[model samples]
Target: MSSPATTPTAARTPRKAALASWIGSALEYYDFAVYGTAAALVLNHLFFPTETSPGAAILFAMGTVGVAYVVRPLGALVMGPLADRFGRKFVLMLTLFMIGGATFAVGCLPTYDQVGMLAPALLVLCRVVQGLSAAGEQASAISMSLEHADEDRRAYTTSWTLQGTQFGTLLATAVFIPFTLLPEEALFSWGWRVPFWLSAVVVVVAYLIRRHLEEPPAFQEARHEVPAGQPVSPLSVLLRHHRAAVARIAAAAMINTVNVVFTVWSLSFATSVVGLDRATMLWVSVLANAVALFVIPAVALLADRVGRKPVFLAGVLGPAVMMYPYLAAVHAGNWPLIFLFGAIMSGCLYSMANSIWPSFYAEMLPLPVRVTGLALGTQIGFAVSGGFAPVLASAVAGPAGDNWLGVAVFVTIACLISGGAALTATETAQKSLDEIDALHSSRTEAAELQALGTGQEPAAGRGAEEPAASGAGR
Candidate 1:
């Protein structure tokens, strides 16, 4: 029996939690996407100035974009536990400020002409801060929204966290378009700074909205159950109880390679190699992501109804096949085909996976370590795959930059790995977090008993106990 205060019906504020998650993720990703657009369009020239080869500069700038991702795993180790221990709102507010401050600092940095080698050094530092902040942002937002949601609508509610990301990408690219078209000198000197600087305004707005968000009832209940002065360590629980779940999530997150390739690498490949107009390349992302803003929720709604695995596997595999055609359209220099394929690949196919991953991944863990597991697992996978995807895609495309086939093959392989991982997961969308935890316990006990070749049934409460209990809600 649950107390009225801890009851799901009484305590969950699904709409408010979803709204906070949506806005915070939007702002966080806007800061992130702004950096990606700049990396593709301008940062190479400004920060990583090269004397002769433009290819080296492009690679170097893309490398800095990956730098944030490289640091993200470390950030997850820190922020994940903090969020699980303290509260989701604390991590949300803290990360919002960290990302906003770092992004604003990027806009004010001196370029290579003014500061020589020190210019890129500063840019990398700011990106490090952004990475650390981003490591926890989505995971906490998802946990907050998921915990506040009704059992039947968890996937749909958590989908808004990612829905916000689509809006952010759309907004970032749209905002960067005019700046991309500016006169070369002015574009390099001042125009690029505006977008990064503008993150400040959104940060304040997000903070105001997020400040009033109540901690979800599930989290509050779990905290109350802990003995005073004896805090539970999420990392310990995670490593002891959830290693397989973490590994599965890390592999599944490789699906983000599709997103990275679509958003970052393709932009660079089209403009730098294929010699397409920069604004045209940028708009392809803008328009595709604009459609994705709508497609994401629809896909999430479908996930809730159909099951996470089918929708997830479709998202994973659809991009694998779509990669070839999308890149071919870019190579052919056909604008209509580019827009058409880009919209289908990014806007429709990729949205299916992206919108539901927060819930899909989070549902695999119990309530106590949900945020930590989600953060560490996804960050590790994102760093390994999505983080380095641009540079890897650029490298495989060959030095001549005409090898579109190799890039497509690379994306296909990554997507397949993700889809295979998705196949191993039990369908979690149809179950409550408690049911998921009990299933994990029973499976673990079954495995242990099987190893011993015993016919005896384990004690009823032995495998499924406190700290890993249903009361802890994942």
Candidate 2:
């Protein structure tokens, strides 16, 4: 039950872990964001050509964007358990290779004109591989960051995971901008593939950073806790002991729909439907995410002080209210309002939630199931809300594809679900992992006692008696 080699008190490397997570996450999301941008701007024509009706082409292209999400939950079921059982660093390295390889392959695929139905089929297969790799990326990264962090600064440290994502989105959009401005013949011929091909560079950089990283001390210690040859089943533990935690996390993560709608749907709506300049519309994303690079860390620091729920719920509701006007500005072809609302809604407001969820959700579970629970729950939610958001928004926008009100309403409803779910969560800012684990254990014991009609005290009731953080909300 105890091993000298895998001590729980091993040196913590918060800064190193955070840096590794940031680079790996940036590379993973860069690949993902590249596909989303291509789906919106370029793939509709090259891979999904409905010569008689552009709407069919748009739907097909956006549907491919959702394809990865569809498989992410399935991937999570496999990768999550592997990370929890093997180690965070191992899973992270494996996922990095899978995502990088699949993304680079996207650049080399044949277009619809060259390969007929085979083009779209191959594209979907590559997207499925990407989704599988991404399934465990964020969860494993969050676990690594949280385990390595100082007790007082988990939120700030974990925020780097999402900050990297913002940077990835910015880089992806910025790279795609010149492609949009290319001469139509050249643009369609080869310009768009350049961004996907560039994924190779980031893969090498991220792998170099992640490979040298050590497994978190917490994970290593947990590995030794079990008797040798009696492997831990993280899925069984997750489903049996943490169903409510998983449900709440899944519901709250629906907030990511704001990002999908903003980054992907809005881009296509502005350029393809509303006749906006493609480069200008792309710049809106590039600028908004550029601002998010600063905004995410700032808001995360605030969450560390004020508690995660308040900052995150503010983000959820702010975007819900702002979605209407943001889409309205786009539909009206008003440049100033578009940029203003876009930056405020996504760059500032959405970053608050994005910045906090990694720390907040990870704190809801114990060490053994942390990665598994986070990956499965968040991936399922993402598949439904984020993966399908662009396709759903496009479908709801009426026959003319300009029903901005319907899209706004859809996003608002997703926010309501997210906010409502977040309201039910315990505020976990500034809590140490041990304390949070104790709290969850206490709750589980209490629930089990109730089910058994025993009415006994929980063994770990100390965590339940203490207030989470000064002024932390329910």
Candidate 3:
């Protein structure tokens, strides 16, 4: 099945794949995460009328932020299968351009004063495209990176994608902080649009970097393994065989709610409700994300040796305990306490789960359905929890004041859900590609498929006796 022309180029270099994944994710999320800051601070007034109460406007704006997540599952449905079938590099470039165009368009939209209801309508439409772009970005990037990695280093390699996320957040808030210091008149009028416009620059930078990357060898081998005129459908296979994986992943994915609460909702709460200075809240994002850029990679290295479950579970429980104090610090308007607690909760503890989930979730799936499975399961959970969290948090805090108790309880429950769900998965840190693939497919099936193309070793099956990674069989 190997064509002489393609074999040498088929397997991407792990370093190239990982670096491309990192920059691509950083650019996509820079576009994605900046919307949260805008929703909390700018969009409420520019897109929603002053006639709406401030709290209601904030809720409406946050709802627009959620709109992308609401439509994300739909995006996964469309984009996931394409990546699975067509190839990861194609979908990766496609989303890069799509999100770039959408983010730039957001900078061009007319405010409520200029265009009335049409402004928010246009904003939602742009968010929809962005939602679609994001749906495929992570799944494809993670799948590509994970496949390229050697077994011992997969968790560490894939985590660079999420490290890119921290960089994206850092850049978004870094751009936002200076704008917030502008005179209120200018800040509300033009200051806020600068970051949105800068998305175009990041887009060009990412596209130039990403276009040169190759598809992973395993995906190419898997594609070649199928018989002529009988190409397997990734979606059909996923729905029929991996429903349990989907469910487990969705539950584990709820950890995103903690992130949403910390990054978007908490920032809004501290500034709007507790009257903490806007600059101070932005610094929380800056510091936490800055810390995470370092912390996530370190945790990923640890997960590589010890296994993902313990690190992921620790990430879950740490935040469940810490959310209360973090919110309390915000309410007290104690700047030092807010800074300290925010760094601990979001920067350090949360980074552990954030880094590991890329490999933890990806390895559970077979090569054929991995991209689709990762995309759909995570997007569905995110649609319900993270998408709704900001709107729900604004509502729980009431129109006029802080409701730290209600908000804290909401985050804690989400953490517990993610932690409990993670326990159900088998630890995958030490497993090879074929061994991991055999966990879901029959051993004979895995070998027969691989033999048709790559001619690698037949799987010994997922049940083979061997030394277990820490927290295996939990």
Which candidate model has the greater lDDT, 2 or 3? 2
Which residue pairs of candidate 1 clash? 367-473, 367-474
lDDT tens per residue, model 2, 1-474: 345554556678999899989988888878888898788778999997778999999989988877887889999999998887788999999999889889999999999999999999999999999889897988999999998998878999999999998888778867887898999899889998999999999888888887778887756554544343334366876787789999999999999999989977898899889999977987787778888999988998898899999999999999999999999999999999999999999999998899999998898877667888999989888878866687799999977899999999999999999999999998888677766766676433333322111112223444345432310100
Which ranges of candidate 1 are over 4 A from the true structure? Answer: 1-10, 39-61, 110-120, 180-190, 272-275, 391-400, 441-474
Local distance difference test, candidate 1: 0.83
In terms of TM-score, the best-performing candidate is 1
Candidate 3 backbone collisions, by pair: none
Best by lDDT: 1
The C-alpha lDDT values of all candidates are: 0.83, 0.83, 0.82
Residue 333 local lDDT, model 2 = 97
lDDT for model 2, please.
0.83
Q: Write the per-residue lDDT of candidate 3 for residues 158-206, one digit (tens) a residue.
A: 9999999878877886787788889989988888888999999988888
What TM-score should be assigned to candidate 2?
0.85
Candidate 1 lDDT by residue in tens digits, 192-287: 999999999999888888888888876765445423333446787688768999999999999999988887788888999899998788778888
TM-score winner between candidates 1 and 2: 1
TM-score of each: 0.86, 0.85, 0.85
